[model samples]
Target: MISKIELLNEIGIALSAEKNSQKVLELILDGAKKLTNADGGSLYTLNDKDELVFEIVSTDSLDIHMGGTTGQSIDFPPLPLHIEGHDNLSMVVTSAVLNDNTINIHDAYHADGFDFSGTRKFDENTGYRTKSLLTIPMKNHKADIIGVLQLINSTSIDTGVVVDFSSEDQKLAESLASQAAVALTNKKLIDEQKALFEAFIKLIATAIDEKSPYTGGHCKRLPELTMMIADACDKDDAGALKDFKMTEKDRYELMIAGWLHDCGKVTTPEYVIDKSTKLETIYDRINTVNARFEVLKRDAKISMLEKQMTARETADEQAFKDAERDYEALIEKLNDDKEFISVANVGGEYMAEDKQERVREIAKYKIDDCEEERCNFFNEDEIQNLTIAKGTLTNEERQVINNHIVVTIKMLDQLPFPKHLENVPEYAGGHHERMDGKGYPKGLTRDQMSWPARMMGIADIFEALTARDRPYKDGKKLSVCLDILGKMRLDNHIDPEIFDVFVREKVYMEYASEFLTPDQIDEVDHSKIPGFSGD
Candidate 1:
């Protein structure tokens, strides 16, 4: 009997430590049955509609088990706590909850003032006798009845004969029910808080994405790709990633980080993020440049007419012919320069030095402004922007764009996260850092970072390379994006092991099939992809 009490204490401790509600329910039912020496038991939880729903059921002698991790469902209808708007005192489980007390019966055939019709029918159908029932109410800290724990057919240990539940047995079951109620309540509260936190995080991400039309679904897509890489790494068992594994909590933390990886982008200016051309802010400045070119063309036409009038006044054929030829040549040169400036305004992958010099020459052409003062055709800022050797952004603008990660770190660090999620800032902030120690913000190296962070780094770059919604360029084909990602692997810009898993597991194709257009999903050659040795 003392050993039974010790076992009951152990069950209470186990109940408090459990995190899963299903496991807690199973533990409660199993512990109650063991303490009472019962052959069968069923745990019922109250639903929103004030009905008792079976959560876990076990009948050892009948070889029956259902619910609570058994993978078998309980098909019995729920018992309503009230019938016709009155308290339900007929059913044993419902009576326990309504009275908020334990109900002990020595035999169902002889028990009075309650309905045993269901039990008798079940027994008749199964060819078993019904006896010895103990039902206890599960009340939380608030003293509210949340569920009921019912045990059936307590047996004498010495003779294995069915008998009534003892006072000690009822007390032990009640104690276990109390512990289980607290555990279940705490678990539900924690889960609700977690759900709310995740929803808020996604809301921030969605707001950031919606801030600019150009960003489209970046925040939404990045996390999907990040998890794909992480999952692939976790599944690998015979390579550099063989030791990589993720628990449910670890996966949840990483997923939260992925959703927030670009939260700092909310601080970035929309014009810079949405800059589609070299001279674009508030509106496209290319139109102003085009207006200047039009003025230059108009001036040339005015000069040509003036020269023709002088040639006609002199009545010289040679002079007239020279004027005509010069006007046509000057107009053609102006048109060509205008066309070149237009092309330069639309940025590309690379701009030649000669083309940049031509922009400078175009800037040298003077035009009369609305202030009646001569101004260069292209302003200094315009010249610098047009002369950019790569994308639309100049050095200063690129720095502004790169400042987001720093801002992300700052933003995430300010939040007071719990212990399980303490690494969210590190995982979210490290995506931009390189494996070679040259990447930005903190400049973390490969050995210094976690695998999930590195996986996010690969995901970030891959999504950027393949995204179809950017204002600057069209999404690249699968082969092209993979080629660039493979090169990034070789350049030490990204984690090599993660990149290998990304390809080996075909994570890219899996993402492409879902998010990319058919045209962008081109055939890829495995051998041609850089830094990948796998077939």
Candidate 2:
């Protein structure tokens, strides 16, 4: 009794509003089956294999349903559009698609020209009757057949008996198919575009990672760790993070932010990121320093031999003994100085004032006619490197490294992210910030940052601490890393509440069990942790 105009309008509205393509396909078939009072219905889409694949199947009388939103698999083989290079239009659905027209049969048992043996076999096997049928070709806006809509066994509303599909039924189905085609086409395009955008973002992250072997897995690992922590926070219902929650959209936004958090590293110089030693540039200049130590040792030996000759020439036995003692002392001093310089070259947490003074004192020693002229034992640049207060980088190089967060913010701020992902720039850029307002870039405090951003901050720090791939230091054991993180929590460098949840939930251990080496996985005592309470 429903008017065709009203039904078509309703179908258009539903199809347009649907976001999930699978659900949309099911809706189309359901609507068709309802309008015609069909006992069974199915939907098929063309796969890349050039076959009509069964997407959804529904039959009310036999209580059979599969595929689509039902999540049941359709074990039936695909209907081939072409077999052995010929258009296989023998099947009713295939004929409708090939001809781009609706095929309405009063009864499949008496229908001519098209093969219904499969239908007959299905009826025989299931003891079900297949009578009235309507097969409609689904064509998109491009006038290309994308799928087919087939309804079986139209029944009377008054008696619930099998009947032929009316002309009105055919018209209603074709109209519904048209609306469905447009909906499907739009959804496909949207999904394709989303996939391309994500791929491009990951590609940028990959390129940044490729710039330095020391940080090879950093960009990838940070996002994973970020999500792990975020998920933990979102799922926590018993702590400071109990109220924290994230929808699928929020998770997706955070994922994109995580991948792009270090995108600015692409602009960072590789030498700084991959600097393996204090004096490294094109190569480790520690070798040059080693050569200088050799020359100094050679000069010391020459001086001792000259003094020995003098003592022997004058028959000064006591003087010979003194000369021998001085020679031994000089060799010992030179060896100690060389060892000190070698250790300094590798860089560490701190370089003491005394170490810097010794480097200066060693630089005063001259190597005559070395590389065509007399040169200091250590050049000015070498002296600068040896005196670096901490780590492999000089103060200026550390500044350059810190500027990556600023650059990350600038780059992400330029992007036109959709409303759902509008916070990505802030979330990504805030990873370097601290809870106590002491961190870099904008110096956002705990209150200033979002929960997801705080989650990312923990992820970034924890991953860096546990990472075995850094050039400067071995990955810390789980207990040692947790001890450091606990201290960071007490110091307010990271969010205390988030860290509490992280510990209570054992997120770090879960992560360690996956990414950390076997040696790094060790027992952790909560009481020894700097700021830990109990689980």
* Cα lDDT, all candidates: 0.91, 0.89
Pairs in steric clash, model 1: none
Which digits, one per residue and each the tens of the lDDT, describe model 2 over residues 106-137? 88889889898998999999999999989999
Clashes of 1: 0
TM-score of predicted structure 1: 0.92
Candidate 2 segments whose C-alpha is farther than 4 A from its true place: 1-8, 369-375
Q: Candidate 1 lDDT (Cα, whole model)?
A: 0.91
- Writing each residue's lDDT as its tens digit, candidate 1 over 222-263 gives 999988888888899977889989999899899999999989
TM-score of each: 0.92, 0.95
Q: Largest TM-score belongs to which candidate? A: 2
